[model samples]
Target: MLRATSLSIVLLALCACGSRAPAPQAAGVAAPDARGPTANAGNHAFQAAITADDFAAHVQALASDGFAGRGPGGIGEDRTIEYIKAQFARIGLQPGNGGDWFQTVPMVETTADESAVLGLKVGQTVQQLTFGDDMVVGTRTGQARVSLQDSPLVFVGYGVDAPERDWNDYAGIDVRGKTVVMLVNDPGFHSGDARLFDGERMTWYGRWAYKFEEAARKGAAAALIIHDTAGASYGWDVVRNSWSGPQYDLPAKDDPAPRLPVQGWISGEAADALFKAAGQDLAKLRAAAGRRGFRAVPLEASASLQLASRSVEKHSRNVLGLLPGSDAPDEAIVYMAHWDHLGTHEGGTGDAVYNGAVDNATGVAGILEIAEALRAAPKPPKRSVLFLAVTLEESGLLGSKYYVAHPVIPLAQTVAVINLDAMAPVGKAHDITVVGKGSSQLEDLLKVAADRQKRRLVEESHPAAGYYFRSDHFNFAKAGVPALYIGSGSDLVEGGIAAGEAASRDYNEHRYHKPGDQYDPTTWKLEGIVQDLEAVRSIGETLASSGQWPNWREGSPFRAARDAMRAASVGSR
Candidate 1:
């Protein structure tokens, strides 16, 4: 659901957490307050409020062709946000942002000219690579015409500069005014060494966004990532398709992290060719790059590319609806889902719209259902609940990023964030998949809730793909707010794990990101998603009622940030 990413592989390999009976509390973990009168009342009301028919109805409408795929900065966005706003109002939610239901997100959209080819000159052997086949390039400079003339090419392995981990790919290398090429994922992945940067689990450093940011920080003129299916977790087609369309970003003023004049991905074959021309073996160099103290390799090749692009400044809205608490109104629990998908492809042959039914229409509908349950409860939560339907998630999570920067409630006061994205439609399951498990105490509460439902919590099967970092919750996690993102388990109650895996594989191969991702009433089974929503509601209700603030785990990268923020708040008080 997070742009061109897919979780079918992870789902296919899902393993059960053993027994289906109510699980006992693990050693030293506190049992959740599951038996509280208020919680029970809320749970009972939740079951009544959240219905499969209602969820299916919402998804059907949102993913219908009339919404035109819910693209931001288009007619689809207008209809989509208004539908969400109308639903919130119907459910008795107050406008969240200063009496306004929408928060304006300023964006810069750049559509590159796909006809432009990447020119490479390795010692007078000029190789003109075709776009969309050999490589795909774009610029974030917001300039009309971007041109580079024979810049020196350097291979900065992974392009990571992490002093805390004592791994610096750019160490002792001056890549200023040159084009730097890097490998996807991190050294730990290729090396299979647990000692290097979280091993298979991708750190933020492994993300392509981070690679470009680090490249820009090192004064590189341009950056290119070598695309491999294993490292990138998707095929070259995904890279091409995702990068081909109009790319959106927060305005330079709003997001001042860094920018790249040119950034894109090249196929593995293209990389091998370039390396061979430069008198280097890509495989050997890739192996060397994974080792500690690996220096930057000078390719002895120069690269040139001219990207001509059309740019536009536009504004999209983040739809917010609030259910105010009776007591602690300032404190809040946030449930969010992106309300955008790949818009209609104009001038295309057939089936242009990418109706994101399971991709995120399901998620949006999920929040709406959860909102109804919360509002229907006999006793309201002590802390407020905010239902946020954000935009531009397909374009690098710009909406959530902006909300984190400019929140209606302060991050210190915000309790936790629960994100729902791409809920599977494969019926009921015996378990639920917790993305980025063991990151926070929220999972402890989730486990308790699962146990109550005769279900168990299982970690994502593929950690190397970095599924945790791919969604909207990652932004909240970066800001030190404990966040939880759970997926429907692959072990179906009726047909078991094999059937679930088959369903996931079918979706991955045929419908994911394609026009076929439409809502189908005949085939879709909403029982599993309903269960997932119930579990999420339980977590939110628990946190909202209690004064307890869930914190990141002891060894998590986010723990320090949470500790600092809490300490500062206390000192200020």
Candidate 2:
């Protein structure tokens, strides 16, 4: 899981959101037998192999304080990958990456000096904003000292430039060498207007990563997104915690995305004060920015920042294990989960290890259990199944991104991706929440599997948070592979939505990304997660056993890429 960077606190409001229509069932698809996969004795064997006890054991071992929170490039990472490799070997999976169990992902880890401050000069007065309080900034250039001098600031509405939507915030303004200030999310979010950019449901443009990328493309010297709880979907504390530590990025040769010299978030209070100091009303500008044809607003201020950072170049590993197919071994199905989390906080008071028990010790355990089940089955599928436990997800999905770039199997021949992240342990539920539902045929497969369990599939309660783009599957999705990410549904079979909501809220407020996220067997429940793993495993098994090439649905942003790749694959043959 990627922490609060994309997980919405709005998930806590699942109960209050009222009734959501059931996800559209895949047409003409017959549900599997509810008694389990009994047609083939092998299928039944695999199903029986996935048990609550085994899943719990994996979680316990991975989330144990001895793992040191599984931080990438640390001792925790060493133990974590070795543990995964050992498990894979025990389960009879072969090395997936060219006869090697590990794929080395080169990364540059940069930790910015937190004592640095952002200085805003409006007219003759200079207002200084403290780091971690008023603003959080970092440099991707891998520089020790990144300085900006008197860079003029321009308020770019949502920092979006979608020509298809007939909207451009930087239409007449050249932001080159200037600081581009923007609001969080996209134009449609705050306005409540479905006519604009997918309405409340966030598009790719709404993500902060997108905003920064667009700003970098425009030659901006610096980019600052004004943070609001509703817009970013998390609080300033999340931003502070996530950004305050060492940030990781792939080497330039590997990732080639436009790099920003400096970029970060500004608190709403700080943004308001800055806007007022520049003789602009933050509220009014926000409202105006939501409307179409909104132009950039140049603030009467210049910004200067001096950032000092400690940079370390290191290599992380993505642990891979393969169960080769009987027929089409080259064609593959991928089951992935991020294995890294916020590691032990140096010099912290108490309970420093961010165990990430739910954020994703659960997810890693999930794939392991699924792998065990498949490996124990009487027969292998026609297409290979790859169990991937990736690193640096907390840093930004870096491991998965690298894998997609340099894959063991070509992206064109890849069947589909099933991602498990932050699976809620809220016991058995009546339904499962599909993050970014209706985007692919994978959901249809999931729906059929859910039907077998007497459960329904439902859309994530808060789509505006863009949970789809948050996880590792997103890297595969962006590359045109059909990817599915599902979280445990809040509609618990015992307590319904209310209990689910309460649990979600408690996790978000108290434990999420904190030391409080330790594994507690006393309180932890595994039945629901077992069901989730089995359901997703069914989807993977179905894909592996057949020749189906699942794809992104029409109108999906990733559809074009998928169509192009498939076409090219056919033409190449």
Candidate 3:
């Protein structure tokens, strides 16, 4: 999860609509045991390997203020990597990247000047939108100075141009040298119509990254998404906090995607005001935009913005450790988590350290614990198990992207990827929420493991949030690897589903992507996390031992990529 400056209203609405918070815990009330169904499961050897104490210890050390939030390219990165490497060594795993524990990811860091402003003009009336409040803008063009003067503004609906779905928001419109404004998510989300863009479930087209790329390909001077708490899956505060910090991206020369001069997000209130100034109703436009054959509308106003930025080139490392397979060492299973977060942002109130306790400290720690468990197993996995703690994930999955480009093991031989990111602090539950649940056969293996724990598997509670595409695993998925992302369930045994849902809402509102994400052993229920880890370990072991090569589901977007890779492999053999 990306850092946010404000609490998300959409997050609140979704949580409330689906499940209300459970009753508050009385002072000094003990939390549930971290030992879930695994304690009595048939797989005694596997269950005995993961422990609550070990998991809690890892999170506490990684999330502690001593690491300075684990920001990539910052001093924190140095500490985080060394810590992960030392842990892997302690567990007796070999260095994964050809005798080296680290893989260098080249990046360019850009920090926009705080004084930048977005200027809007309609006739003689001029409104200047200040940075961090009315809007958040930046330049990914690798230019120190960027400007757009008197550029005409156009509303491009969701800014999606998917010919496969017969949807094109920019039809019959020339957006060259113009500023394109669009909604945050896809059509089906706003209209609640199943026929439009995966119904309520968000597709890749709805992501902010896709919006900017599509706008740039269409030759727009800038692309700005109108942020709504419900639509963006985050609050205006989140937009501000995330965009204002130092931004990292692959070196422009390395990145092939066309990028616009300016890309950012505008607060919902600001977008509505702009709509009114242009003689259109924001709500009405959204409704019409969700329908088929909607045309892009030109706003009667013009927008101008100048951004001044400072740039630096640096290299961050991806920490990798391997438990080489005793049998087929070339074939592998990968477990990954990002080891970076929003570094120290001086602008934050109270505490400036954006301690990402849950955002990713938990992920890094979880993988480390999993590594230890695998090392202690009675028999080594038949396929190599690579533990990857990547850097710059908060900076748009750059490290993972780089790894995929320069893989330690060929993508074709890799069996599957299991990613853990921003795990919740809630304790054991009756089920596990698998993000992007139906995409591949990996879930089938997960179901077998979950069944052993006497638990069930459920889809992500908030599919509309588009979390499946938000983490490091997406890079692997795009590379034809079947990736699995699961989280602690919201079906708490103590407070039941109500309690579980309440815990989740509380984290999204107060802790997610914020400095408030500090670890609290006094109240934390690691049993649930430990339970989840055991299941993940079980899945990896099963895949490693079996001859089955899990494939993507029939119509999954990544299916063709996997199929082509498999066919090519067979031809090569």
The TM-score values for the models, in the order shown, are 0.92, 0.92, 0.91
**lDDT per residue as tens, model 3, 6-62:** 111122212111100011122222222234312211222222367877676677767
Error of 3 at 409 (Å): 0.5
Candidate 3 lDDT score at position 24: 18
Model 3 lDDT, residue 569, Cα: 83
lDDT of each: 0.82, 0.81, 0.79
lDDT of each residue in 1-573, candidate 1, tens digit only: 222122332421111100000111123222222342122112222234789988887888788766777878876777788888878887889999989999999998888888898988987798888888999888888999988899999999889999998989999989999999999998999889988988988888988888999999999999999999888776787677677768888899999889889988899999999999999999999999999989999888888888899888999999999999999999999999989887677655667777788878988999999999999899999999999999878888789999999999999989999998888887888888888778899999899889988898877766777777777888899999999988887778878777776786678667777779889989998888888889999999998899989999999989999999989987998
Q: How many clashes does each candidate structure show, in the order listed?
A: 0, 0, 7
TM-score of 2: 0.92
Off by over 4 Å in 1: 1-48
Candidate 1 CA-lDDT value? 0.82
Residue 382 of model 3, lDDT score? 87
Worst 10 residues of 3 by lDDT: 15-24
Off by over 4 Å in 3: 1-48, 347-349
